[model samples]
Target: MIYKVPFVEPTKNYRMIKNEIDAAFFEVLSKGDLIMRGQLKQFEENLAKFVGTKYAVGLNSGYDALHISMLAAGVKNGDEVIVPAHTFVATASAVVNAGGTPVLVDVGKDYNIDVTKIEEAITPKTKAIIPVHLNGRVSDMGAIMTIADKYNLVVVEDACQSLGGTFNGKRGGAFGMAGCWSFYPFKILGGYGDGGAITTNDSRVAKMARLLRYNGEDRETGEYYYHGFTCLLDNLQAAFLDIKLRHLPDWIKRRRKIAALYKEGLEDIEELKLPHFDTPGFEDVYQNYVIRTSKRDELANYLKKNGVEILIHWPKPYYSYKALELKDRGFPETEAICREVLSLPMNVEINDKQVEYVIKTVRSFFK
Candidate 1:
């Protein structure tokens, strides 16, 4: 079935910068700088500057970024890291991978970790708070930072979906001790494949992360310092990401425009709840334009039948997996959100006409 409005058009995204991407491939291929090369270093520098950090370490994936950040921050056995239950599984999995337990927290109406709930979750073992800036909206960093200071907890942001987003004039990852970003193809600053970075103002954290990503090797001195994982961001993928990063500002602008169109067309529908993109001091990039309605399944089926493709981000809670054994730890907001959230097509490539059709089709369903 052909979609009049598909969820994402990656091919079109590539086409928009095809010439530059092609050139980058040719340059990297001819030079044969396949791993830990100049291309990766340049991308890391560019990303660190963009995120307002003193240093950035490129890694293989967002999961690697988070895991290495935890390791660098001293998250160890018996440590518990606070995380919102609504984000992708990687956030918690990273904690577990770093020999820590993920203490689940619920999100507020904004679909970010509820700052009010964060303090209550802290314990003697609580080591860090991984505030995920989900759906392109920045979490309340001011409140989170205050809490972290009080408890002496490390803050490593899950800023994978909010590369260009900001709060109170400060970017997401900049506020935390360390921030983890993903370049998975669908993210705001995605690459052709998996890539990620850790940004930090702390030189210690930055240096440790850099070594941890390269399997504890001192490349210049040819020394193995400690046991570490081989998770360097490939030079080829880094080159692709660097090419795409230049266009990220415009991409973020277009996503917000699409979000505005959705809000204008659908705000009046009482049953449908839309995200607030115009909140003061917060620059939302609308990574995914998710709306909440009790009739989510019905609405999703209707949208698909009408050639408007959509997505439902994790229709179930992450703890639903029996193996994880988080079944007893129930988060009410997360459970309710899973039942109601529906993500309409949010591709930057979506045209106004396609957006209009999506709006019209959604309204028709409600009517």
Candidate 2:
């Protein structure tokens, strides 16, 4: 029997609860509120409770969530916001969109911001630090938070890849002033299309974020208005997300189980370096299940030829391509890792036999 492999499959909890979503949609349609309505409110409240945050503001996309957070945090033009050089461009672009200059920082071997190197980069213009939790692993928040306190710099966690992930028992989106999440169909707690939320314990910051998303309407009066962009999450998507939210904990556990199976099967192979999920007290959701290999491009081609799918999370670092000011600075770690990182087949639906087949194919390539 032949088995076809896929790179990353979004969990299918939505399929199992199709009737619930249909019923919710019918109720929404009957009420004649589709855009920003009761469904959005319910999702925000439920998501906040799940993340253990005081407030959660839903937005149009993760990019928008980051953008709005920067604005709410008082980021201004010419102000410097320190960010990792290795993440998706959206992490940095959102800073620019909110009128801040993004200063690229190098990442450590764990593929997160090198906390040790952050102090030297801080300048008089430095206003905030955006710690990106890439590939579902938590960046060293304990250290990062300490640094932020020392400098009085606001921390905005870019937790797009780490919805169910945690650090030191606290969830990913609650460590900073506000943590940004992207529901771009591929995230663990994804919706049907573009969606995002900002989770935070600070009520003032949360209030600002909510106002920014709805064209600056005062939620209390529904009367006052200010200049703000329209980027609210749709009711239909929220209805769907509410259904999937119930099973998120189970889905996250299943992802970790699959990652363990991969590690056990592939640990002996020296050619591959797998990700680290056993960070002291935190649990990684294993969003991408990336592996590092010297011959990554060649291995990817071989896998595709053998009916196994693979993908590169990022081919270039954010600072190298989008922002021109930081081009002269060299980030060898980011560049080298980008060249070698390849994502394997990962999802809850993949059975034991499929995992074995993938490991066998990978080992055969190395041999």
lDDT of each: 0.91, 0.85
Q: For all candidates, what are the clash counts?
A: 0, 0
Q: Cα RMSD (Å) per model? A: 1.1, 2.1
What lDDT score goes with residue 66 in model 1? Answer: 93
Q: Which regions of candidate 1 fall more than 4 Å away from where they truly are?
A: 277-279
Which candidate has the top score in lDDT? Answer: 1
> Could you say which candidate leads in TM-score?
1
lDDT of 2 by residue, 183-265 (tens): 88878878889999898899988888778788888867996455888898888888888887887888889889889988998
> Candidate 1: lDDT over CA atoms?
0.91
Give Cα distance to truth, residue 247, candidate 2, Å. Answer: 0.9
